[model samples]
Target: MVRSTAPLLALCACLPDPLGRCQTNTDCERGPAGSFCAENVCQGPPRGSIEALPARFFARSETVHVRTIVDRSHGEPAVHVLLGSGAVAAAREPDGAFGADLPLRFAPAGSEGPVPFAVEVKDDLGHLTLLPGSIQIDDAPPRVSVDLASIPSPAAVRGSSVPLRVVVQDLTPVTLVWTAGGAQGAAMQQPDGSFIAAIDTSKAPAGAPSLDVAFTATDAVGNASAAHASIPLTRLKFVTRHDQPIASIVVSDVIWAIAQSEIWILHRDGTSLTKGSTDATPVAEAATDGHHVFFARSDDKVCRMGSDGSIQLCCGPFTPLTGGPILLGSNPIVSTRHTATTSSRLVAVLDSNGICNQMSWLTTVDFAAAMPAVGVDGIVYSGASQAIVAAKFDGSVWTGGHPTSETPSYRGQAAIQGNSVLVSTTSATIDTFASVPLNSDAPTPTTVQAAVAGTVISSPTLAEDGTVTIATNDKRIVALKTDGNIRWNATLLDNATASPTHGAGGLVYVGTAGGEIIALSGDDGSAIWSQKVGAPVRGPLAPGCDGLLYAATDASVVALVIDAAGLADSDWPRAGHDIRGSGDARRPLRSASGACLE
Candidate 1:
């Protein structure tokens, strides 16, 4: 050890060429498969050499991000990444690590699904490495569609409830958005391939109204598909029988009654119908007890039909007071007659000629024996049934006596209110005429005015305000009070020879000779609104539960909704749909290819 071996110096010279053309420690030490010698140091990689960062992809309106890290790549640790042309250089960090976030604003619409993207990386040594695969951008357009298997044209009626169907296909799971012109309501696509929706024209306005429904399917990726359908809404009127030519129509709660040969339900409107249905066997009399209507037929049959067509009773052809069935001796006279209900019981008039002895007079039936009615009062002045005639009681009845003071002749419907009874008179000149003063010995005249004349078919009906309304062959709606003073007269269209009907809220509804329905102001007799519909309506007006008017025509039954809010035409809802953000700026909806929902 004192002198040191002579071979040791030679061994140092042969150790490994430590300083030869190396930029890193790895260049000098090749230890394992993953390790290598570089430069003049024992580092991981050769100086200024790096692999590229992974490539990125972009989809519908999304972004891509990439990063490059430096770890012992040696020689100032410089790095640079290559991207598509026009790509700005991403800022590098002080530690030689760089990151970039690419805002992908190039997602296309109106195109099919599943698009593509690409990216690569590089190092300071001018070395490059591409990613294993290209990035995929799936910014596809939405898929929208419709079923053209069978196209159904719009019905003739204006504003009828109709349903349209369709199927849709799209990318990235989509939902269906429906718009009418500018109205909007999008429905979710069900698991089943088919879709169903209801478009209600009931709430839609009258006339040649234009309605366009557009269906658009948009995927979550913003892709979309669309289709459209257009329809015209025609106005309609209500009638009782669908087969017979409708003369006039009326709705009471649940039933739509028309004057077809006999009164029957044309259609069922609401949920509750008390007075079911009736026939034209000459209704001796009819009484409304709010919920139900009871009829006395000429055959001495007491039939009660709910407005809904539910047959409540068929009671009658009863045995007379003396013994036999209480019936008339004459073949022309009807036996079972009028009504005057009392609280806690129902009462009716029995037309009988004692022992069928060839003389026609009226007998009485107990309130308990008669058919029941809704709001009747027997007490000296309860409410609906305040007045009782001699023909309504059995014990003190007037048998071979003159007809009850409240007798109904072979004309039309009559209303008995308190001490005053309103009846419609048939004449040739005036549309409506009335004779009042029950106790007064008034003279019955053939005609009211010698100046004007026409064949009036129905008796004059009195309104709640004591104004009598009559329809005549002269095509006029005349209103008069008990004093015979004329309130007002409405001249109808010459060709429109149909009768008129009075509804609640003092509104007068009438049908014209030319298939038109007009609502008039009851107070001043002014036209509220008029619209032409279905076939020529021949029937009378029928009142609905909510003061709605039901009219009958030769074509079909129609219903009308009153405009109570009174909005201006231009200010109407859904009217501004023609303009929106993209041009017709109004609502968020895009199209109307289907039905409209309230």
Candidate 2:
């Protein structure tokens, strides 16, 4: 056996000498982590290889667990982080991989760029390996805002599309999503580096006040930002509020109103007519003949205004008239104090030359209470003592009073239906109608009493089919046939202070003391729709030339959009026979035989 200085070295004989000198590969003690023979000497554990796993980019705010797979071919390997001071060994992961964690604080202070980093693997014999600059870190979040100039003036309209634009300031690619009015969608990138989206408002409520929009912008590296905006929305095409209690409204080419003192003129669609007022404040309701407006001024004079708002005629300064002016042919007629008795009244016809034809007949009876109704002939009918009498423009008695027993509703205007004159009256708590022959000189009294559900509170409105509709103090709407028979009676939420008016599609509209407007079907008295106005609606309700319903509430004159075209084609659709309050029933009509004749 070969002699050796140490016994441990003597057993192998291929071991390196104490001075670390070797003759061949077997001359050195070799293992996974032991010294290896190289160039006839014990060199070292061979340099090991290493790799950092799951290579990906990270934000500067993130902490990275750097997992490393180290080469174990030579010896038990170890992983380390190369710090500025010295190398620190990495701990063994649960899966037997060696790695270390790099915290967010590892990035140098005030560093915005990607942090340079490295990893090292070593064997038990002091060999080394490294992985450098294989990781990148992002620094900042995305900045997002809305381009205010791109928003529309009225940000949203019902049943229309609203567009939005977004601007983002970021170095990385970005994705944008938007939400508005319970809807969400992704925004499309524009060529100008902006994001664009269109919000659909077709399904929004008719009374919605506004539309809210929000945006979330996220960059490719997961940096996110948010933005928000509110767009004022228009609810409907026709909504206006005249800040005063309205007494009366007339709808023609223009909408006319007599508030406390001022006359408000609006387009048929509720837009401002821009027509300035020059005439004196009107005391009575305004009237129109489809060309000129007629109203009784506060100065106790009758004035005529052109549709363009110019004063055409102002006659009188006469005795106070109980009702407004009415048109008979080309002249205006009014009811004034009778020269005979303090309790009775007379009709004054204003001629083309402003001459007052103080026609007097029933100075012996109670005459001239409500506004008079004109027939197809030149006859004018005025209410009298328990009767309705006829008079010609030439101051001749066409017929004596038609007798009745019911008390005449001084506030209820009269109507001329077909062959007789229809008038509303009240007997104790019951309301009835008195009819008289239109063409008969020796008129016979025909009192048609209506058995209504409640006391009549409004004038009798006659439809084209001769159906009469009225409201009562008992919160009911009752319809009556020509012979005074009950047609239908519908319950109401409150007492209708305003007269029931007829509209298109056999619908009747009434305003309640509870500040609500209700639409009911004339055929069967079924509810159609209702809206609140926040104040008592005591004045008349006028349906406009457009699909709008104009109401005079205690607080304001409001215009609301509806589904009807205009007033119904009837004998007496609204108050005073027409929107003009003309009270003229001489217009051409289609008779029962379909004869279009007057």
Candidate 3:
């Protein structure tokens, strides 16, 4: 056995080290750390300033870790580094930059750049010295830029295609991302710098949303550029609060008001929420009893449309007059100079005794048929249907008034109240029209009396209990007993043309050319309140649907609140003109019948 001074030396001589420490006895002349004197650690000539890629290069680059210089004395030399934490370790290439052979798969993140800690110089003597700036690392993040055309494109010509382009650039490779269209579409990225996407207008509506397109571009460094641009699109149909209706026609809850042309569903608040017809042709007058709508048709047919949009006509021979008469349920009323009242399908019209023209007669049509047409010359409700009943010239051709026992002085049209026809006829005769149930009833008025003589009868209105109220053009509102006797008399702003509509608060309303709507005590006809809505009162006034009053004027529609506390005067309608477009009927289109075609 070879005598050994240390057991370690003997073991080293026996086994071959894969570390390539020593090959022959001659190699041992350098010892475990190379060349004998070096102890503990052994290393070959440290790689010369390692050539790193991305020189001091960024982006995890490969590196070269190999001996650069050889030791003539053949001593162990190892590359080492001193850490900030007072630790010592192998010294890597001066630069952490990636090298070809010794690759650095990882890159320093959030750091200035590849950072080198310290470098160590080793000698065969087993001595080491830490060099403060032995390594040079990279610092600096990449700069990126993105280009976007933020201007929104024009409205796409309904059916066409448009291109949206975006460009993203970076000091390094860049990923371009984008989102197009809506949820139906998808988002994606094109590794390339600029991307162009096609937006088919053919798939869009007329007025498609040409909203600004949004996008973002980020370089590998996580730097981003926010972008925005308007896209051009086609048009189809778009509805928004931007759209406003020109006019609305409203009437009683159960009835449709014969407004300008179209049949509009009525609301108590005077708001006509339905889409009105823009046609020039007049339709028909309908009534809503707060529920279903009853249309008084002059075609001799009574039609009804429910609030739910259901439509049907009660079958009958009742024909509407050329000019539809005032409609009550299916019944239509019209007065003739010759005194013949005809309706939609009614073959038989009631005739009165009077000379055509000067003769005035109020004839009621069958409750079964007829529809009202549009225009002011169409239907006119007689203020009261008693003596001297108000006559209408529904544009057709019924001559003047005629004489009759129905009350020659009739003015106020009769209001049908629970089984009784209350006629506040001719300011003077307050009477009730009840078919006495004959032996099956009793003795009815064998002969109806006429107005005392000369006095002209004003229109009459009635209360729930058959009390008659009549108004004379003379500005006075008179109340009468159910038996044609005067109960009380009240005055008004001016000549009253319309019938009185009673309210729940024991108040009565009437319209007058006096340019004001007067409210009077239901019983005494005493003035309770007055409001001067713009323009002279035309016929009667529609009581508010929901505590508001509605008035018709050439200026426009207006609403007024019922203030029992005496609210001050105001001009709320003026403001409405600002929001709604100033009425401009420039559109060439006429009747919805497709009549006025260009």
Candidate 4:
């Protein structure tokens, strides 16, 4: 009996038939107010639809207002937003449209992209209409990064502009800005979607070790991301003073020099601290033990001066000196010869305070042309005629002579590296560079020899890689591999007046008689840059702790700015190796941070 009544009710419900039009729920329109879809026929309240809605949603907004166009044909209607969580009731606005506050509570955290939602409009007659899945949601921030490889070099010069490359990934467009060293600029986008920015270092401080560049990328909707890149920077500054400087050494940020027959102590800024008479014939540069300076006065005496400019003590007039004094521990040792050709050569050692210990002397010594080098084992090495001599102070014993070449010529300063002593000798007949082993235990401690194009006037310097860098009197700079093979050679613009010194970043610096201080790449022996002083540069380019290159020329002493914070981190970076010109390669004086010490 119930089945018979259902058949009659079904026929009455299809008064306005349209059965073929609605095959699925999607085929029906989302009507509002009174009208709804049933069997493809509108029934109950009058029809209405959602006219406007936000095209996208943001999770940070917390709530969204949805507007609907409802029909008044079915009296007053109620509007609601149906999210994945639950329904949110809507109220009529003053403009006549129904509005609903859709909270983000219905959205899962970290959810993004198109979030399907439904809108419903119901009338008093209980007829409903729906619109589903039309808006999108965005919750992700842009990905940001910096392309470090795109930076020009590890170091940037002051008052220069350097370019940086940036990368970002996001669904929306982003804007970028960069800041560094108190400078800021907008990042420009390239055709390939990468961004580029140029950093101006005009106002950046010259002494800072590096400049840090930061970038921030923001999307259209206020979601932001950040990235950073750091680049080392170099600022060039030159300080010149006409102090009549000759040879100089840097100790603890102070400059000590033999200037115009006087011992001058100066600040790195060229300000004179004190000056004292040196008996009119100050024969050598000053040496220090980090607190006091030792010098040779014309009276054939070894005098010690405190760093405060006062003479500490004076040792008795020793034999006529030939080269500058050097230190082994606290003792100031000097080289003396009665005459150039005479075999009457003496190596005298004096205690810390001016006390002479006639304990060590060599009668067979034929020549001592340059300052001697001391080994870590307290062995003093010098170049004698045709040989390299080693003398130890412990027992007043000499290691005898290790002959270098068959030719008898005076050798300049010696640079000791590891167990070997490197010496260069030049004469009318032959010019030789030798690396002789100090250890006598080897069956045949073969002397490694490398031929040079011309006379080597200064000691050889060792690169960090153990390559030997030397300057020749013939205006040439040469580098030799560890095996004594020629690595590279560079012909200088003029004859080198002093030894070549190593600087940070694999650079070699040398001064020339032409008044030009030149810098060369240690790796390839290529010219980097050269600055000309008004006078002949007479000595090594001294690297100071204040990031300045101190050069003593014939006319004036000048401080040239460099890109290094301190000296090069190499075995034998400079002539005489350290700032003191100690010539001891095995134990170059250095601070705990590896910076050269006085």
Best-performing candidate as measured by TM-score: 4
Q: Runs in model 2 with CA error above 4 Å?
A: 1-244, 269-281, 297-300, 306-312, 317-320, 337-348, 351-365, 376-378, 394-411, 428-456, 588-598
Candidate 2 versus the native: TM-score?
Answer: 0.55
| Backbone clashes under 3 angstroms, per model | 87, 3, 98, 5
Mind giving the per-residue lDDT tens digits that candidate 2 earns over 374-404? 7655577765546555666554333443423
Please identify which of the two predictions, 3 or 4, would achieve the higher lDDT against the true structure: 4
Q: What TM-score should be assigned to candidate 1?
A: 0.50
Backbone clash tally (model 4)? 5
lDDT of 4 at 576: 65
The TM-score values for the models, in the order shown, are 0.50, 0.55, 0.36, 0.59
lDDT of 2 at 200: 67
Error of 4 at 16 (Å): 49
- Provide the overall lDDT of each model, using Cα atoms, as 2-decimal numbers: 0.41, 0.64, 0.39, 0.67
Least accurate 10 contiguous residues by lDDT in model 3: 572-581
Candidate 2 or 4, higher lDDT?
A: 4
lDDT of 1 by residue, 515-565 (tens): 878766668667766767646765454444332455556746666654331
Give each prediction's root-mean-square deviation over alpha carbons: 14.6, 11.2, 19.1, 12.7
Model 2: how far residue 235 lies from native, Å: 8.1
List candidate 4 stretches off by more than 4 Å: 1-240, 297-299, 316-319, 338-343, 351-360, 395-406, 427-457, 532-534, 544-546, 586-598
How far residue 366's Cα lies from its native spot in candidate 1, in Å, is: 31
What is the C-alpha local distance difference test score of candidate 1? 0.41
